[model samples]
Target: MTARWGNACDIVVFGGTGDLAMRKLLPALYYLHRDRHLHPQTRILALARARHEPEAYRRLVRRHVSQHVASADFSEDSWGSFSARLDYMPLDISQRLEFARLARHLGDSPGRVRVFYLATLPDLFAPTALHLHGAGLVDDQARIVLEKPLGESLATARRVNDQIGSVFDESRVFRIDHFLGKEAVQNLLALRFGNALFEPLWRNGHIDHVQISVLETVGVENRGAYYDQAGAMRDMVQNHLLQLLCLVAMEAPVHFEPEAVRNEKLKILEALRPITGMDVQDQTVRGQYSRGRRAGETLPAYYFEKSVDHDSNTETYVALRAEIDNWRWAGVPFYLRTGKSLAQRKSEIVIQFKSVPHRLFPGTTPEGNRLVIRLQPDESISLSLMAKSPGRGMALQEVELDLHFDEAFKRRRWDAYERLLLDVIEGDATLFMRRDEIEAAWRWVDPIIGGWQEVYRSPKRYAAGSWGPEAADSLLERAGHAWFDERGD
Candidate 1:
């Protein structure tokens, strides 16, 4: 289905010369343009401190775009047209006076959809918004997109929200968590709410537990400085994993509109059982990776990584058991784990159903049914169920009924940013986070961080190539559960 593209718009990307823009945002826009999703008259104006002419900036963008964008999608003809829409304006985001130049570049195009994508640090979010407003850049039809790691804590998140909210209304603010844009992530809503198969059985009585894991094979590479300050909790758990949990656990929205969908997600965040005091110690595991091997190559520990503090107590890995107090998922626990320098790179959500009341086959043990929704490496959904052996008396084995996205759908799969950028242009906030939703998540996450600071002196150590610390296994073992290893089957 083609998305409804709005009228000609201006997408002004702040920090356009930065890593995120060069690697992700630009390429995503290129794909949108290639697929004919972008309006013909749409203009992509890049604002940054780097002084470069429009042609020079386009050439610089071409190198990164070619490296990141797939060769199959990158045609000379497409790049020619895509580059025409790209413009560069050298202006420091911190300086309010420079925004007037941007305003002149944009001109007084009435009713033009203006999007200011702040791809810079969280500190710049407010200042950029204020300057945009001061320069008469922000209007009723204008929208602003804020990147992740919104703040260090709830108080700071509120401050950032207030500043951004001052310029743009809640409806026009799009706080992006790129994970929300994944095809499988959105398919989750369709699998539950759109289909009649699972919604009836999506409760504690039917589901035994849920596991959400986002493991990375590579460490903090060049983001060591940011990784040190944020760690796994603030970086991944507070936003990505919690957002995933809400989608899996939230009650069906009355409608699929922006507010209706986000309102239900907010309810889940508020209903989350707080992990504090002794519960933090018992229900959470924090770890830092040590030297290990990956693909026959030696890898350094998190502390030894470039730009990282050698004696930092910051955690590179976190595993927590989360519970929702609502009726739908009252007793069910959500096992959440995310870390760097792990065994493999994969993000998946496992929904294990309750076992049968009685064992029909005395000789064979029946495995419980499970729905595995994989988000990376491959986007697919597999239902695991016990089936009778081909030639045997009362013999059973677990088999997966799979739907691999690439194989199931013979079409080009879009990168997360592609869909998300398009949504912003179309003024659809369905996939974006709302103000209340952000605050609610931080409210649940803040206490756990405080508890860790007060109690734990240091993060546990685990080998770089391993899944996580031994404590993570123990966290699940205590609940009579285990981490589902995709490679095992």
Candidate 2:
């Protein structure tokens, strides 16, 4: 479907004073506004318990936006024009009376497309929807955006969906997974389907294994309480990593529209070989970060993090082998891993092709061709090829043909949130997760979580600055493969 870009819209962000608003949402909105991507009649309303007036809130937003957005992009002229569209309201969502005030504030603009972005806790998602419905604000033009950690498990996710679905139709609900909005992730689709080179060989016979890792150098700073309960598995793997896996493994859709794309993703999630019973122990590795040193500074253990239990058994890392039980990817393994307070900050996917049938070089046994798609620490796609060294008897050396997005585009790349927020405003659910997609992800993840509780009482410990527990390495080593480190090796 085409975007509803020209339509007048109202963008209402709940928890407008929260960290997500300051660091991501508002800054993204600022860029959209500066670029004139937003409709001329569009109005942005931020609702929070903070009692700042509209002008004061704009000033506060200006400060935060200036800090988060690059100085090269920020300017007084743009802020002045953008701030004209900004407004604020103070209300407690839990209070039923507050809805009346919000409805009255909106002043009966049924023709305007309304987007209610819930940047609050997952628990607030359903209630906010119900409140909006009761407040007579759930018109046909209204849409709702939900943030991640949708629920702790499948049951809770269904519960949230049922509750929110009761108020807003599934089509009007946007389940945001910011990872899918990244240019590199979208380019995976382009690189696969757009190019004739990869599709034919993108199967088990040609590709050996896939490695998807999202590593971080920073620990759970203020989210220790949430992290302890959710951990790396629920927080990162269930949504981000699985979504990446789907994009890599899904079949070519009939068309590039929302349902067509999501249907393919659902098939991949359903075809995932279930890691249950004894399989979990063999295919999965979980670890908690312990105190260690990185660079010149010492990093604290997960247990010592603020709001975390001292003896928390929560895992801060996860590595698992996921297989698609389909014709295209039957035997190929997709290694998914993510961790906090690790050696580096990177989000990348490594597609390792199978080795050549015969070695042509007499002295050198060259490695297979590899494609690396990096999403963060710079967005780029590089293919590793074996090239002959200078003046040698068939000596082979690995070289990369890299296409960095910034260098090639010669323009600022849109932050994931920036693109996603604009998509939501324009009523495009192509990048958003469907209700079935969310439940399907939870269905695949729930069994492993149960396996962890039943079989492994405590996660294995690894140094904070290390890649992960040694077991993660061995998880691949058994298959004669190794986790591809950041150095492209």
Candidate 3:
């Protein structure tokens, strides 16, 4: 069934009944509606092959939203209003007649903003866009949203971009990476540029090294099929971790607008010193998680995960030291590590400042003055500095000056999807990945992958409950550094 609001925008979700839709998108939309972020006239249309009436789909969404959303934020009145904006259509995207029917259902409104959010597989992105174009559904007011890990490799990514470009102009395309939407991630800009305290020391002269880690406590129990093929390199490193790196390393933009912000990010990506051949062996470490115990419970190894090959050589963990060729970060190593089934679930960036040239109180602080930006579990920014211990003669101890966003702001932090989805609807591409940005990231990543194929065939094995293989620690230890273990440290 199809319904329309008079001349308002139509936000169509391609994979309306999928996990992403139920868990992230619809719940986000509900919040936007509840908070009055969406326009009063806007209508949400969910497109999928799942056969269901409009009300049936809305009920299904209600159950999910209730489970995912916080009790304080959800209410019966808000849900009633939000559900009224939802409409569902059971149409197979591959069928031309289905698209034709969709066209008639949407009708032609030149002024209406039509957003086609493709939450399906990357292979379907181009075809769906072409289908929309062929059915006379695309216009100047139309925009398309594509999810991350655009393609498996550089070649496929370019091909997908080219195909989608043929239907929608670059300005009309939005490639989303939800990591960019995190509040703490965005606060990096304000911390670096908005304040004069840090920008001067943001370079190699004052900084020793940088660490970015996106660790998880869950294994690939259900996503084993996709995880086995892509591994940690393609799955996390290629997009999310890289995007975070760009933001942290990027030069201040002339303006905070879309193109200005993206242009600066692009420069950082291009300046990344490529890791290839022998450098891959020296700077990169890949590992597969082995079954182990954590917190008195046994965990399964990557090989035992559902849909994974017993002999799969895919890496469940990756740790690498990256450097930028540009002057600002020339000598500073940006260490990135990500893995599944780790001891903790947290995503963070640690900026280790250089120790005092002359320490008056020796052995007081071993970890040097540092700035830590926590992105998940809890979002906060903290700076660790040495303070004089009570009733002591210059006895120093490390104390953190912390700023928790929730406690400071006194409001609910919007979900990453909530901010990103609204950004798409309003045509603000500042937080999105551009076509060239995606390609540049792949170019830097491809050489490391190629080196793995040629020499490093099988990934080393580490206990599932541990950080990663011992080699990951060795990767940093050679440079007189170590992985920043939040819990241990």
TM-score of each: 0.97, 0.98, 0.96
lDDT of 3: 0.91
Clashes of each: 0, 0, 0
Where does candidate 2 clash, by residue pair? none
Clashes of 2: 0
Q: What is the lDDT of residue 311 in candidate 1?
A: 91
Overall lDDT per candidate, in order of appearance: 0.92, 0.92, 0.91
User: Which runs in model 1 stand beyond 4 Å of their true positions?
Assistant: 1-4, 486-489
Candidate 1 per-residue lDDT over residues 362-446, each given as its tens digit? 6645778999999998999999998887885868888999999999999888999999999999899999999998899999999
Clashing pairs in 1: none
lDDT of 1: 0.92
Q: What C-alpha lDDT, on a 0 to 100 scale, does residue 126 get in candidate 3?
A: 86
Off by over 4 Å in 3: 1-7, 362-367, 487-489
Candidate 2 ranges beyond 4 A from true positions: 1-5, 486-489
Score residue 244 of candidate 3 by CA lDDT.
Answer: 93
